[model samples]
Target: MLDRSESALRVVVRSKFYRSAFLALLIAGIGLSAATPQLTLFLVRDLGTPLPVAGLYYVTNLAAPVAGFLVGRWSDRSHDRLLWFRVCAVIGSVGWLAMAAAQTVWLPFVISTVALSLAGGSMAQLFAACRDELSRHPTKAENRVIATIRMAFTVGWILGPVLGSWFGGVFGLRALLVATAACVFAQMLPLGGQRVERYEDPGISPLPEGRRRLDHMMPLLVFTAICVLAMTGDTIKFGYLPIYMAEQLHVSDSVRGAVIGIQPLLELLMLPAVARLADRYGPLRIMTVGAALGLAGNIAYATSSSVGGLFLGQALTAGLWACVGALGVSIAQQLYPEGVGTASGIFLSSIPLGSAIGGAIGGIGVAIIGLPHVFFVPAGLTTLALVAFVVLTARLSVRMKA
Candidate 1:
């Protein structure tokens, strides 16, 4: 044990990079997260949009990450991570403002696709910057450092939903959107004029000849594919859990809310431990374990008819996200080792991409299999992906050992 808590952690605690990056992530998380829990409701109930039209809102989720990936790639080339971060936040704020003032039916779609999606790339830039900052001090535990920063965002998500719900109810959805915009703009304050260097490891060993580029990219793509599948399961749970509780389990509002909130809260608690585990057993093995647990968790939700079962299932799935969300970026950065910005962008984009898939899958699966068991759809798909990952990694490992 390196007593990293006293040494590296203290360094993180005292550094300006940690303070600014942590607070920016925290603020941005709250801003974006606060708006999400009520998006469908705002679209349908307040805006008078039809259910079918409202369902199309998830198109924004798919669109944002594509723009984010591009912004990240640009940052690597432009070497202006800080500039994009601030610019994206400003544009995202304008998007929220547009959303608040939206009188036309089609305005939200345009703003989200054109403006806010660019803002979605902001977090990647910040994380890329954080990676650069970490490069300055090799003594720091990289996994733990990144994990610690992510936990701030996790914490914000934990609190944001509650506040958003209350604030929206009391002050109206428009006011809530305005407040969220303010929060988005505030992300720039903590990071104003802050230096954000681009960094990649020069120590990465070259791959075997002829297959260098593709082979080098395999691990990054593999892990990202895993995240995509995992988030699909998560997206299913998130969209359906409340509906499931009301229609099937017949649970009260408080109980349903508790179950909805439990996983992220659990993720906050699990991050440090998973970080330590990555320090020991490595991230990919841990990610595999997480996938296994997520598979089991989804199965639990599919089979059960009771509230307790949902709780148990949610608690189990926390392991997967905790491992993936924290370690996934580092794994991508390490595997790429040429561009942290692009690596992080592609990896972070998995959530939205999987979300786009999850929306379609959840709709079709529910139509066919119905409630509770609809979960098995994502569970089964994830199983297939997991098997592929295992086979590919095993072959890759054998090739390396040879």
Candidate 2:
């Protein structure tokens, strides 16, 4: 009876670890999404910046990827991943608070870089810690776990816009920013002082020294390239879709908000099924299908003439994003088991890198050609990603079979 009771206690404790991690991710997502959607608008309305300049402000978000990679690499070497998370959360909270107080453009710009980067780094560390914990347990399904995390993030995305709009409407953007800081600080409470056991796969043997470096580097490179392309296209759509709805379609702010909200809501519905499929069929295959969907969705966005068409485009994009969110991290963890933290950092960084490039290019495109035409660029980029994925996967399969 004592043994049985002890076993049950261990099980409960193990379950709590995963639950806490998921909750932290959910809260992080809420904080980020709440302020991000309105940042461009805030810059324009409050700071008197031009639309193009406001859009370009996202280019400064390059801090996220840079910090994500560095922190991830550090976590790989460090024994206590949660400690890094706590430090990052504190830094991010300070940054958000500062942003709330900033009256000048330069202060927000400089502070945002520090705050967002640290926050991103914290998320990367959290993911790496979760992956390590999953690996240690082995009974937990990685794809399912990843899917749950994605769903949590999707839920946050769903709530974030509503909260942002409500808080901004009721109080102001500064209040919304302050709320975001509070959310970031809240994550530390659940995750602080929690340490996860690290596990390295015993099945993988050391490669021959001559071929070792090349073989190790190739997978990371392939994963990074694919992620960069996918993120670039996605960020372009995310950054400019609102503007396109308002300026090109002459939609009301409420309509634009609804349209923006639809994608994540659909994603929340799709992620569970997508995770099941990814676990069964493999993340790489599902990711390919997702890339194709992204291409199609971008094309739809570029050509749509009616509100119905816009809805269809966003629906398809949501499905694609669900696949990416569910599968991408799982694939990264699988590919680089030893350096999960470093790989995750690299993978997470792709978002900011893509966002920076996408924002800069989208801003320029909007200035040169038109708002609707900017999506064409992502459509074209997605096509290239598809082509590369097909060719690379085919060769990889042949090698594996050999």
Candidate 3:
């Protein structure tokens, strides 16, 4: 019995589909994280855009969900998701190159917006691919696989910023952009004609003719929206916290970088345990706890008057994100297994959408009230999201019992 179990375990551990999906996601994460920290800085410092205007640049993210939804729907219908994946990588590479060569503010704005949007769409496709891969191997824990992918991403983030800072500091932001483009293109080499098998469950029949699919999907959709609202707090912090540290706290660039890097590093420590809890308790429950932690973190930020307090708040914030970031995709994949691509797209799009709206609002709030006071806005948003989510789960439970 032990030998048979061990043999089965080896087969799962050595699965090509699982290994390939994780590798692709890890590389993509490296490319994205390496460039992300420098983007707003490049615009504000190099291109002479104000913080508020730079914040407005994220407004372009409003259009990304549409792009994601379309690409995801198309990926669901397409035979070769790998083909679409390669195309997206190419598009993202070109966008990075355009950003590298951009002389004017509008050019970078347009390129960043379009490139990141395409990248977001690509990510949706990738999640669908991963889910398809996961479907083929039933013995593997689905949430665990998802958490492992997120760990890959967190690992990339841990390395990317340090690399970006070193590269950008030494060779300039253009060189950094070029390197990022290379990283994006490098993700393509690993594919090597590997195709994701489409998912089809034999036991589950199609929905009846009169039942609207949208009706069945509404609860999850509402849940996604609430999650987005909660995410806006993190977005606000990402958009403005570095600036706050630099301008308000008068920290040096190196210190600022360390402060920014610490969150993901701490997150790396938390993910493995969080993944286990998610597997045991369900993703939503873990997410709820994370949301509460996020609220506390935001409040800490609002009250913080020193660098130590800021760091403390950021640590809590990292804990919050580590939970949601891993589980959000898992929940979305579970909720809409039939259209994993579309569901994942919607889930993926929420990040940027939340960031765009939050950054815009944060920028305006900073301009009006002051940087220190802006933290309260996100706290309020998170509170509302948590309330809505609790109500939603309660209603769902009542219905289930009935």
Candidate 4:
């Protein structure tokens, strides 16, 4: 009874701001989660697109980061995340609707690349608003807040594929797209009436675009690059792992599903704990450890194919992503505290950017070295990223001291 009560209490989010934000991300995640996995199949089965063309769909996702960065900068400059967020939500709705109505390959591709790309930034706005809200409602557990919000999104990812599979089989892909649009539209509801507490002074004008801020930010930008590289490994493993499972390991589809599903599930469970530890030990140190774990996981993939080996690899890689997905945005927000919108946007943008890079690298790796040895590529990339991160951090510290 006591344990159950504690667990129940642990799950509850007390703040209205947090609860609403959590709910909104969950909805958005569901909308995104459901559509994305089915897109290739939808193209092949519904649109009669060739497998090669469907495979190239990863290129279209590159638009999200580019569009989101612009949106994030716009929201920061305008100081009206609310308006832009709503506009994005509206755009997302229209984009999904357009996708659903698309009868030709060219039309849906255009909608995804253009409209959905713009719509993707709505999440950046949401993260920025949440950051702004906490400024008003101050909390020490900011990392926890971000992690819980991410956990909400993870939950949606877990459910989205399953629900999408069911709905696609039953009501059809068109209905799933319509439902995805509804989820996108509903994102605006949480923060629709919410407002930010903007600080301004009549005596002091805005800070000029100056050298000081750039010097301070350059290392953090380097840090963001490190994260993108680190995350790219996760994407590479994700894109190729199922193929690896079927081909190299001779694993059944069920086993492949379990292996593929393991990381997100473990990520959900580990995120808050990782967040708590991050607050204690520092996100930098924790994330560094996560990077190390990713490198280890990649080596595990390259080295062995036994069940125990696979489990260790999955468990460690989950730790890698748990750190990134849970803490990456918050780290960016903290680093660039003055421009939460822009910082959040940049962090959000890194994901699709990382995915695009990862997909390209994975494809090349498969061709060059064969699929069995491809994990070594990510292992090598993560090691290089970690070395660069250490060098950059040391330089930043030395410069600060001087």
lDDT top scorer? 1
lDDT of 1 by residue, 1-402 (tens): 344444445656888878888899899888878988788888887789998898888867777557866787688776566877887889889989989999877888888788877888788888888777877666437788888889989999998988898999999998999999999999989866877666545675533345775676667777677678777987788888799999878889999989988999998999988877776666666777778888889999999888888888988899988987778888777667666776788788888888878988998888998998899998987797677657655655433211
Q: Report backbone clashes per prediction.
A: 0, 0, 0, 0
How many clashes (backbone atoms < 3 Å, residues ≥3 apart in a chain or on different chains) does model 2 have? 0
lDDT string, candidate 3, 1-402, tens digits: 112122322443587755666666778778778888798888877788787677677788887877777777777677776666777788988999888887777887787667768767776777778777767665335555666666767888778877888999999988898899988888766666788866766754443234566776566578778887887877777767888888889988888777777888888788766766766666677777888878888888888878788788888888788887777876776766666777788788888888878877787788887777899998898898878867775666433211
- CA lDDT, every prediction? 0.80, 0.75, 0.75, 0.77
Ranking by lDDT: 1, 4, 3, 2
RMSD to the native, candidate 1? 3.1
Which of candidates 2 and 4 reaches a greater TM-score?
4
Q: What lDDT does candidate 2 reach at residue 81?
A: 70
148-248 in candidate 2: lDDT tens per residue?
76677778878887788888999999889899999998987776567875555687553224577457746766876776776576676776787778777
Q: Candidate 2: where is the Cα deviation over 4 Å?
A: 1-14, 45-51, 202-215, 251-254, 395-402
What TM-score would every model get versus the actual structure? 0.92, 0.88, 0.88, 0.90
Cα displacement (angstroms), candidate 2, residue 290, comes to: 0.2
List runs of model 1 lying over 4 Å from the truth: 1-8, 200-218, 392-402
For model 3, give the 10-residue run with minimal summed lDDT.
1-10
Superposed on all Cα atoms, the candidates' RMSDs to the truth, in angstroms, are 3.1, 4.7, 3.6, 4.4
Clashing pairs in 3: none
Please give the lDDT score at residue 70 for candidate 2: 72
User: Could you tell which candidate, 2 or 3, scores higher by lDDT?
Assistant: 3
Candidate 4 segments whose C-alpha is farther than 4 A from its true place:
1-12, 198-217, 393-402
